[model samples]
Target chain A: MNNDHNEFMWLDEHHEVSLDEIIQLSGLTHDELHRLVENGALIPNNPTDDSWRFNSHYLVSILTLSRLKHDFELESDSLALTLVFLERIRTLEVQLQRSQHTNSAPTIDE
Target chain B: MKFKDYYEILGVARTASNDEIKKAYRKLAHQYHPDVSKDPAGEEKFKEVAEAYSTLKDAEKRAAYDQLGKHASGQEFKPPPDWSSQQGFQEYTFDDIDLSDLFAGFAKGKGRTHQSGRDRPIPGQDYELSAQISLEDAFRGTTLDLGFTVPEYDIQGQLKSVPHAFKARIPKGVTNNQKMLLRGKGGKGFHGGHDGNLYLNISFVPHRLFRVIDNDLYIDLPLTPWEATLGTTIKVPTLEGAVNLKIPAGTSSGQKLRIAKRGMPKHNQEFGDLFAVTKIIVPTTLSDQERVLLQQLADASTFNPRHHFE
Candidate 1:
């Protein structure tokens, strides 16, 4: 009956770590966190607040963006475009997951 | 020092109409104006255009210049002895424009003679970018690995943006609004012309400790009431770092301590002095006994701080 808790549970199942714990653990500055959110590489539970709450899944993505900018010398605008394109890839993977769940039948082998 | 073809510089034919010549000159002048054009050779090209127009637009000078023939490529293009004394040519003076070496006759090849072709590259246009450094860095020279993007025309004739990284040495005692000219590192000239220069304007970041005037430095040194009254050798911060400073006894709160030759380095003749103004900080929250001691000290002292205001 309670879909709110169900959604949180679903998010937990999808991501290995919760958002609050990740926000506390992340070492990035407020501006850096906001930059990640603005670039769409990070999505926060509280959009109004400046925080890039990253789990294990988002951690790798943030690292990739950092490496591109600091190491590979990609400009902020170019890195933002790369993040947007990468997010699309992540969305497609999620769509495939949903389609597989819908098509699978219950097994009698259980 | 070969003679430059003024007509070729303006991209006009010798028989160009006066109106056509005027129109071309105007267009070329606007494009090659030093203030407007980013081109490295804009200044030189603009001068060349103006010189061409000055000679060709005149009937007599054009006739005389035409007589020189191919020898005008620089060797035998000397003006007639009485060319300047000629009648009815007051409007066109050689002083306004840079006449050829043969015309001016200063030497065979003297003064600001220009070069042509790939052999003589004009210095490219200097590119400018700004950066900020801390006051400490400005006081004690610092170097930065600055990254800048320069728009360069590649071999394909396309304007491509190239990122250049270079170490820029910032000299010590450089003040705000001061410019450092780095020669031979500007835009590439046409047909392999000489490169241009780079100009760096210094800007100092804010400092928590001190404020700098042109060459002088000012800082507020906090002193206790007793130290101001009794005087002491206290540790003070200078642009060169901290130094032991002697404070005279019976010093007022606004008394200035001068440290000679300790401010900014001498740019022209002599270094400036550093002035440390003493600011006596009184404790707001005092113990009963401590308050009694301060009241006793104030009662005993004959110093009146506001005597000058009256």
Candidate 2:
């Protein structure tokens, strides 16, 4: 839940970090990031123009891609497609829940 | 069961031309093909695709599969007493799996003899259910006691109460309409089949003061006219509790104050901003002395909100 929102706000209070911090943490090359963007494998958060401000979560994605590239040698498109498949699975799971009713059914006590 | 009707499966009228049938098949094949499509159910659809195409592509096979109609895949398949015994007889074997196996239970032919005493394991039916939660519970990631029922077969061999409870965790910033999966919680599998999955859709009860949109939270902060004209530091309630916010002097109603990273806790532990919109309230009744002071202040200040409209 959101109880941690106030607590987490101070995580990046200094705001002194740079792309170098992302590279150090995620261990992905600048060229690889640019390639992912060029191939449409990644749609930048800002669509109008390309900016290099990556959120911490985006760094995690880069980390995942790095592992995929190292371990499986998957192309950027293939990794992107895999992410799309995972998203689809999440969507189907959600749709199934909407079709099922947990509270609408009457309880025995009721 | 009777093989699926090739025509119906392809959604084409029997009277349609070969070109029409081919077009329909091409479109459907593109959608259900394993190589090109992303449907998880594509494998099951592959069999159907092959069946329809084989039957429709050949003139002789098309005539035969059409004559068989619902019985194209039967077991007790007794051809019209003199079927093969007649003048022209042709038996076409197109599929690796026995066509009769597909039609055994469907048509009046041999009725399900192969399935005799066979305890087939029917995979459990997938089920979905939603849980509506409170904002605080969503924030704190509390467990919800969700209750539901299923039919339980017992020694008596009749439908019985199979009430069950599951404890579900509400993740931080659990948005409304989002789903959480609880595996193997749906209808029980038949004949020792794998149990189905249970999905939990997230929902939230409306809060008295806060309105959530995605990760952002919005709130209306009421301010006194005096506070709007001559601002002061005020205590505002946030999800994390209350914080003192400094209001700028000469602040006007409809001004927005943002408290950064105080909205919702996201997956990466990031938080959005909470925006507060100010609404200046005017006193309906005033004493003579209060009215005289306000009149003096109004005369001194040359501010008119409606000047832009004019």
Candidate 3:
């Protein structure tokens, strides 16, 4: 058994997804991917260079955008904004949940 | 075997145009997409709609399916001898397979005879499953026995869910909300395409004794009223075990005492500090002698806790 195949790596800068790999996995065209970057919906790990790889964290965002475009039949140009907004909404939802948990703690005032 | 009506699932008439069918499928999919919908059954509904659209969209497959004629959904029926399907003599009990698989097999059988089995390399589908672990498990690396179903098109061209079970090793000290990528642990790829990856969104089960903030942990430390005033050393529970923590004099309820490097462990032997918040517990009943001593002290002490109110 290859242990690496079952091993899990933390989502970090080291887990790099190349441009070609993302397009293949996500079924996003080369042009659609470029437009997402142009709209700032998809940001590369290093904006200044590589321009061809993204941090593994963006996989969910990219896949979600592609799914939305395919299902709703929306063009890539129109979906770039929707993707950005959806990402923001998801982030805010997580933040809200964390905050509620923190606030619900028992504060015993002496 | 139960029969499934693809057109009915998509809410389109048998004679509906391709454009109309596409529109219905899009609307249903948009409403039930797991990531988009809040409905608990959205995932299942979306899959059904997608299965229906897969054949309905293809001209040849639709024609093949239309020949089966309309039957009430979920009615027990058997496929005609001619329609036992064209992928060899293998039989399918709908319980083991699905209506979609049968139709998919029809297409695959057609492709085989027409194209001489020229198969395209189809990439395996990726999957995500959320995993919950205890704080103790996070402190010490643990193994997770995960069981999940992966949707795949088998060698026989039957679209089915392959049950996949494996023990995943979760590294120690993984923070909450972190996603772990398991390479080649997802559905097996078709042809020469690479196997899919699995993403495990790791979360810690709530601990009754401790609340985790990032790598650090906060614990409610209950102390006797005298202990709060006179300072004392008490054993507090940590992720490892009980450890002696010092409670300074004049410690008040809600005040946090930091125990350096005693919380969660991190990489390279680094550790997070623990915070023990003080809570004063006063006894309701006292002995006669204790009451007398307390009354005497009450008479002597002039400390006013409400001085700030003035």
Interface RMSD (C-alpha) of each candidate? Answer: 36.0, 19.6, 5.8
In order, what is each prediction's RMSD in angstroms?
A: 27.4, 15.2, 4.6
List candidate 1 segments past 4 Å from native. A1-110, B1-123, B239-241, B267-271, B298-303, B306-310
* Candidate no. 2 TM-score: 0.47
Taking all chains together, each candidate's TM-score versus the true structure is 0.43, 0.47, 0.81
TM-score of chain B of 2: 0.59
Worst 10 residues of 2 chain B by lDDT: B104-113
Residue lDDT tens for model 1, B1-310: 2457767777778778878877787788668765447898997787677667667776756665665454444443444456433422222223213344223222111112333222333335556557788877877779977766554444533334466677877666566445454545555554465555555656667678776665667678799888887888988788667888888877766666778877786434467777787789987899999989888988998978789999
> What value does the lDDT take at residue A44 in candidate 3?
81
Ranking by TM-score: 3, 2, 1
Collision pairs in model 3: none
Distance from true location, Cα of A63 in model 1, Å: 46
Q: How well does candidate 2 score on lDDT at residue B119?
A: 49
For candidate 3, lDDT tens digit of each residue in A7-107? 56565433667788678767889998888888888888767786577876666677778877876778756978987887788678667755643544343
- Stretches off by above 4 angstroms in model 2 are A1-110, B1-117, B152-161
- Minimal lDDT window, size 10, model 1 chain B: B104-113
Against the hidden true structure, what lDDT does model 1 obtain? 0.57
